[model samples]
Target: MIRKSRVVLLVLAAVAAGVLLTAGFNVSPIARALLGDKEKPALIPAAAGLRMVPVDIPQLFKEVSPAVVNISTTQLMKFNHPQMRNPFGRQDPFDEFFNNFFGRMPKEQKRRSLGSGFIVSPDGYILTNNHVVEKADEVTVTLLDKEEFKAKVVGTDPKIDIALIKIETKKKLAYVALGDSDKLEVGEWVVAIGNPFGLGHTVTAGIVGAKGRIIGSGPYDDFIQTDASINPGNSGGPLFNLKGDVVGINTAIIQGGQGIGFATPIQLAKSVLDQLKDKGKVTRGWLGVYIQALTPETAESLGISGRRGALVSDVTSGGPAEKAGIRSGDVIVRFNGKEIGDEHELPQAVASTKPGKTVEVRLLRGGKETTVAVTIAEMGGELGKPAGGHDLSKNLGLTVQEITPEIAQRFDIENTKGVIVSGVEDGSPAEDAGFNVGDIIRQIDRRPVSNIAEFTKSAAKFKAGKTTLFLVERGEARILLTVKNK
Candidate 1:
């Protein structure tokens, strides 16, 4: 009976296997399903993990290169050189005779240069670097299809090194959209298309190395640094992202350095593009104050906690800042509700504001925080010019000492008679008026200060709400500094 049972069981198992095969049921999967394991097989390779395939960038270039145009400029320049007539045409004894006989003559020369730019609109408005089109007698733009158009300068902001030019075209021209530079992250992939070294429409790829870099190019020196092989003639070209949106305008490169280049953020150009398009000029808001970065020493001296914010070195007389009660030695921590990270950020922030806009300025004064409302003034033609405002009382701003022989040697004052600045109260108006510890106060309101007594007498006559002019000698330069006693 046991042998018969074993044979029966083997036959049943064989029949069940045949049935499962005929029914197209995967036995292992069925077994797993029966065991309550229902997870599907993952596509990610277990051994190799995820893989990145190379992108087809040639298609990207074809789509975007049409907007990248070659810029050529011609300027009429005058040159002075000795013109010698080579009558013999070959080596001759009289070659020296003509060279010596000809005097210096002024001649007109045509200087032609090449650069790159991008179309920002279908109507043919283009953007480029100011240095590329500055003083250009004639500007010409060449498209990828070899079509050329004469361009005229719309406007230029030399402070940011950006320019706007326009060309006339009946047909709708291809253009690239400007991207948000603020959103671009460092290490993000980027591509640059430009006419580098006069080579037309070259494409190079790199990653954004950094942002908010100050290159000392201008007062507003925010630059985007990249490593996309930007070279000469690539200036004013477009630095695009994977989506073909222009995030930066290629502007400068480091000489003798590989993989180092700089671009102006597109957001900066876009901010002033409307003004450039409408009025052919950019007008910015001005808060008349001379500001410097607060170092740890300066911060400690001013009784501040951190080495952040911009230190007010001087304030302009009758300017918007003074009108707003912003004093020298006041550390500006915030402007328009935006925290000032450093000195460079303040200039850019202030310049971007519209004129006549009332903004709140938060500052740290005497270890306390205060807010002031200031109506910004029109920048006009004096964007970077410096003026003066000072505080007079010794405990308030500055102190004077008699110019003794030892003092002359210590302060390097050649003249031995005038009163010298002995101390400057931190954040004082006199300090804000650009008074240093060694500055010699030669005269006050045209009254010559020969000694400390004379300076004390003149300072005692300082009336509140009156502007006092101080004739100061600093490093061989005589300058008049104005102070308001308040």
Candidate 2:
């Protein structure tokens, strides 16, 4: 009876202790001790690590926005219609009746467009796209402070779509420094400042999506693509790197793409900036050689270890290349000490060089490398000469014949030295490889095929499933064609 009474007193005491614990009593440490577990220290975050800081773009915008100006152009467009009434003065019934019999006189219409540009110099030089002010009657530039000035076209390069304009201003203006576009890397942070949609001084930030993009805008299509928001009014605006230097000029955008935009590299603009500013024109060096890209199959057939540089298909008669002993069937590996990586690169390199400057040209002829020093000539010239020809019947399904004196006179071939293709079998390898009936085969597998004996010898060396490159003269241009022998 005494033991039972003691157990009842202990149970009552335990219930009171449980109520105290649930009511916020300090029991965690006591419970741990009772369970033979060690007490853990309270968790406090460490404070020694560096924290992420946001990019400060407001200061950048403040410094660069003043240089970005709005460009508005007025073009006088002409239209002709017989039934249209004149906008000026009253319409005459006699004029309309006379116009019904003959054609109506052309009417002038004013077309207005808006775009963007950036000041490139403190003395009032501005850089913009050529299409913006092309054929424009008048152009006006509006600055950030709401000041307006009349701008004049200094020079335009339609091939690359770049132009330089200038405004006569007495006071010094803010400008942006040109950056080295060749050093621009993909994924680097960039900012685009422009007057998009006529919205004044808009700024957007994005990373460089890619570099050296060929969007087929022109012959020189090296562009910098970015994900930054660029609109119609953004054309000719400057694309700036993080250091506030202008690296690219906004030029084009993909129609359906969300963020895809293209810009002309500033490096190309700098190459001709002095010429545009001073002469109001650009003069590019010309090598007088028609070149094509070297494909892997073409390089392999020629025994070239790597597919690099430009393949010369034709050398203009009396041109710099012809005078320098450079010939067709030669692959140019380097020019003026710069290594040529693509066929497109050579043109840009050559065009950037000064005219009449003698430069070394390294080429691979018959799998042997050689160098020649040649002086570059001014562009915009024409020359022609005829190559020898002969015909042959081989596995490739083409028939060739030698160019006799009578045959040369009939075909208008000068200094006839190659064999002319007389026939190409339908759906044969030759036809599929772009060979025509009038094409003259001058070289086969880099070997000259001047006569029937040479043609027969070269044709005998062709193997099935192996590529055979042919130096063909079609019309005035020399082109290279490759066929996989069947």
Query: Which structure among the candidates has the greatest lDDT?
Result: 2
Candidate 1, residues 297-386, lDDT tens digits: the string is 456546778877887765666789988999666889999989998888898889989999999999998789999999999997744433
TM-scores, each model vs. reference: 0.70, 0.75
Question: Which regions of candidate 1 fall more than 4 Å away from where they truly are?
Answer: 1-54, 80-106, 383-486
**Which residue pairs of candidate 2 clash?**
388-417, 388-418, 389-418, 389-419, 390-418, 390-419, 390-420, 391-400, 391-401, 392-400
Model 2 residue 140 lDDT?
A: 98
- CA lDDT of each prediction against the hidden true structure: 0.81, 0.85
Cα lDDT of candidate 2 equals 0.85
lDDT of 2 by residue, 284-327 (tens): 98888988888877777766778888988878878899899998
Residues forming the 10-long window of minimal summed lDDT in candidate 2: 37-46
Rate residue 456 of model 1 by lDDT: 73
The TM-score leader among the candidates is 2
TM-score of 2: 0.75
